[model samples]
Target: MGYMPTEMELIELGQNINMNLGGRVDFEDFVELMAPKLLAETAGMIGVKELKDAFKEFDMDGDGEITTEELRQAMNKLMGEHMSRREIDAIVKEADDNGDGTVDFEEFVRMMSR
Candidate 1:
């Protein structure tokens, strides 16, 4: 799915357009006001295939889920950054929606989408 702007984002966009165009916004004006924000948000987004690839990379053992250990190892190998065990645990905890001590594909997607 594409970037879903929040209600607050719409409100702010409207306010910005109003401020710049004196309460009148043509299609061009709206596009001009919205394009930058949309581009910035999408720039950070990975496509489904890319996300799946990333998940696979972290799931090192081909187990279809990413445990804290797997994540830590992936981080160390991929990013070359040695994170602490507590830090790794915290990352898994944040994305483990079912509190299962592991992150499955759906949970990983939800975490990344945020």
Candidate 2:
């Protein structure tokens, strides 16, 4: 899944830009300003929300975080195989950017993005 801002989002952004600029921006200037701004906003949003949601599903304890055991169960269910502890450990280690021995939403997102 991906985050594509709706048409309404774009319209609201344009309205915001117009308001901030006192509604005096010419067409060419508006395009110049909005093009890069929209690109940056969308780029930042891409796959971030989806990855968070995916992490939530793996976080079976409802603790807003995922341990290797939780990930093992989730992957076992998804892949229909009893994955070894070493395999699960490798997955968590790769995703655990902070070396805190667990995967948080940010870590999960970063791993999925890669």
Candidate 3:
């Protein structure tokens, strides 16, 4: 891992980014500010095969895409965290670039890589 940022550092970065954006921090703004650091720290840490495996784990029913129900079940089973439908919907919204209401392999890869 390359220089994982401390909590304080992350707070400071978020504050700075928020200030730069006129006190408004949208999702894109947040992602733009943090993506570089995140990419740097995780670069080469995960390979394509691992990503595929992860995607498959979430993509229950071998459907080639992760539906909200699949994600919810996966989270509950794998992480023991019972997430609400709204929470799962928000996650899918963030990762589903195609707006198909599901996370495909490519979208999952992009989300993880980011």
Candidate 4:
């Protein structure tokens, strides 16, 4: 197996993607705001279809609206393959506000929202 990645690995990977996106947000809106970064992050690892597929988890009420937990699960699923459980936990804990032992949807969206 390949060597496990460190905390800096994920952080650095995200930073790299942000840099590769090559511009700042032009709009002040949330959807428009994070569009670029989100696309960039999901480009190689996740994608539009994959996001839509994963979004199912976010629809907590099943009213077609995405919640925070669903979002977190999507992200965890995306990058989880690239890192070890310990590393994933450390990275996730930084964003898990409820301390529920795992990331919830809202907290996840908030983290990505940052």
RMSD of every candidate to native, in Å, equals: 10.4, 9.7, 8.1, 13.2
* Model 4: colliding residue pairs: 68-105, 68-106, 69-104, 69-105, 69-106
TM-scores, all models, native as reference: 0.61, 0.57, 0.61, 0.33
lDDT (0-100) at residue 78 of candidate 4?
57
lDDT of 2: 0.74
* Candidate 1 deviant stretches above 4 angstroms: 1-45
Q: What Cα-based lDDT does every candidate model obtain?
A: 0.82, 0.74, 0.81, 0.51
Q: What's the lDDT of the predicted structure labeled candidate 4? A: 0.51
- Candidate 2 — which residues are off by over 4 angstroms? 1-48
**Residues 2-107 of candidate 3: C-alpha lDDT, one tens digit per residue:** 3567899789887887679877788887766766666544544676577878888998899899999999999999999999999999999999978999998767
Model 3: residues with Cα > 4 Å off, grouped in runs:
1-45
Per-residue lDDT of model 2, residues 1-114, tens digit only: 233567986787679777787767777666555554444454466654765577778999889789989988998887787999999899899988679899887666556656
Q: Give the true-structure RMSD of model 3.
A: 8.1
Clashes of each: 0, 0, 0, 5
Sort the candidates on lDDT, descending order. Answer: 1, 3, 2, 4
Alpha carbon lDDT of residue 53, candidate 3? 87
